[model samples]
Target chain A: MQTTDISAAQQAMADESVKRLAMICWSNDLDKVWPTLILATTGAASGLEVDVFFTFWGLRVLQKNNKRFTGKNWMQKGESFVDRGGTDHLKLGKIHFAGMGTWMIRKLAKQYKVASPTELLEMALECGVRLHPCQMTMDLYGLSPEDFIDGLQPTLGAASFIDMAAKADITLFI
Target chain B: MAYPQDAAVQPPALRIDALGKKCPLPIIMLAQRIGEVPIGNVIEVLADDPATKTDVPAWCGLKSHEFVGAGELAPAPGWAFRIRRSY
Candidate 1:
């Protein structure tokens, strides 16, 4: 009986479905975006169904224009000025010398032949990784679906994301 | 352990030199080029990225390819991964 149970368990393991990787991206800093894209692309490349949920500051990356602040308040305007631009314009977390550090990182990445965040995103999309924006955050910021890059899945709520995460083989918060 | 001499005689059908390339690039290059070799034939990937140590095997597992083994490339700073196309 024990042997039969062991073999049944092995059969179940063998019959398991394809692996899934779900990630919650809550930060949009240059440093964070690099890892997020790298992992997403790599995960997809490695045969996992990769889904990245962009929320809060992380949604800034999916915006059509990185420099524009949609908010009406002065603080929002100030944040837009400081965080101007999309993936290419993101600032480093530390030693950000008036955008010089971001420039230097880009230059070094080019020199080393590393894929930039933009390129990684493109590759991830090509690899069939799903990109989802958080609807709650979008509504909070008054952002519509048209404001995001093309091919994004419909904006999802946290509960929907949780459902996806519950079934994923791996879940990450970035 | 000693293997049959015939096992050592077969050379890789394709070799990818990914030295100096960073993570994802090496893997991307391998993914693109693995198709160039015939199925069941072996392809050797030379990569310097530390991540490739795990990444290559993970890719093989995901793609249903065989991860034969990895060995150091003598006189150079990198690894040579041997993968057999399973399908």
Candidate 2:
């Protein structure tokens, strides 16, 4: 009887838990970032507890000075030059016409009344989506907490993120 | 088609025109303005974006609002979605 009662209590607790979505943002490409923000905002709007862990190049999305690169290595600096600018400077994955593709897409987005990446990011924040920066990645890139936009939670490691993701109903690596 | 409620008999308390707005904007506007009307009153949203068809209903379900139904808006090239504020 006690075992049955304990099982029932566990079931009840599970039923009352909030649904969660865990997303790992591993890319900073414009095409990739747009979908990440879209899904994050949509998930939050759908009443899911959403957490986004930004790592590697994904941390560029949160940079305050998007055009400037703080990397010490020449290769890292070259990458920063190629991918300069924050969310606004992201280029398309295919047929990129020396920044023209980005311009054309932005124009079409405006014409179609689609929200831009920046706007979607704002919406995601407003919707209460939790944003986390990978501490190890930040150290690799020499990024300080002050470099990121406001409202982000403290930088965390993969272990902590894994723990959170284990409890989530949905997990995606993007 | 039969609507969930007599939405035709009782006019919407507030109307939001989101004809040209795309995904997230129309739904965002609905979230912001649904509170303008009193409880139990309906709000009518006119939109052309295809996402609205699913987004509005999904939003209503998430917020616990009553999604009355959607119908074509004749004379205009758009759809009208009615949502009754439950809380």
Candidate 3:
């Protein structure tokens, strides 16, 4: 009886199922970008469905001039009420410096054969990684749709992203 | 050494041991190995961490790879997952 049960369990595990994940990314630190991509790509590679909602500085990863922007924005003077230090304040817990991280990603991409940010964005799309920018965040920052890359998906609100997250088997913040 | 005339063709293989590792490691290790496998091949991963149950499948979904399922190992130390590279 135990043997049979073990076999049954094994068989049950071997069955294929689609896992859903909704990732909420709010960091702009460039070093954190690859990990996010790596996680998303890995999930897709493993056959799970993924939705990525990027907000605030996180959009920089998809921006064309992301690498050009350095640490000191000089715009933090009066923005203490909102995120205090701008992108720097909202970076990932593991990575605190956006400038150094952005530089590292560009440097590493060049060192290896990995695609550029633009190419990576295309690759992400090709892999079926759904991307949604945060509407409220864009508006709060006074950013227009033209600020983002062409073909980028329209912005969504936190509620919309939350709705997706509610159904997801996994939700990540990076 | 002796050579067999009827040898079977086998795909490349990789083993990611993420036993006792944390949330992203299991997924990270699998990602590193997935890169080694050619498209249409399989990569095996052994992880004892509970987070892998969710992380591995989620990672697969993001990359379009086929998640082959994972479960507890009886009389053993960890769970094992099989991922087939589709791209």
Best lDDT goes to which candidate? 2
- lDDT per residue, candidate 3, B1-87, as tens digits? 111221113322777777766545466457656779788777878887776778777777766787776656766767777777888
Q: How accurate is chain B of model 2, given as a TM-score from 0 to 1? A: 0.92
Please tell me what DockQ candidate 2 reaches: 0.58
Cα displacement (angstroms), candidate 2, residue A5, comes to 17
What is the i-RMS of every prediction? 1.4, 1.7, 8.7
Q: How far out, in Å, is residue A99 in model 1?
A: 2.3
Where is the poorest 10-residue window by lDDT in model 3 chain B? B1-10
Which CAPRI quality tier does the interface of model 2 achieve? medium
lDDT tens digits, residue span A14-96, model 3: 53355777887676654455567666755654556878888876755554443232222345223323333222222334434
Q: Which stretches of candidate 3 lie over 4 Å from their true place?
A: A1-16, A66-109, A112-119, B1-87
Q: Candidates 1 and 3: which is better by TM-score?
A: 1
What is the TM-score of candidate 3?
Answer: 0.51
Q: After superposition, how far is residue B31 of candidate 3 from its true place, in Å?
A: 12
Positional deviation of residue B27's Cα in model 3 after best superposition, in angstroms? 12
Report the C-alpha displacement of residue B15, candidate 2, in angstroms.
Answer: 2.4
Candidate 1 structure quality by residue, lDDT tens digits, A85-113? 46766678787788788899899999998
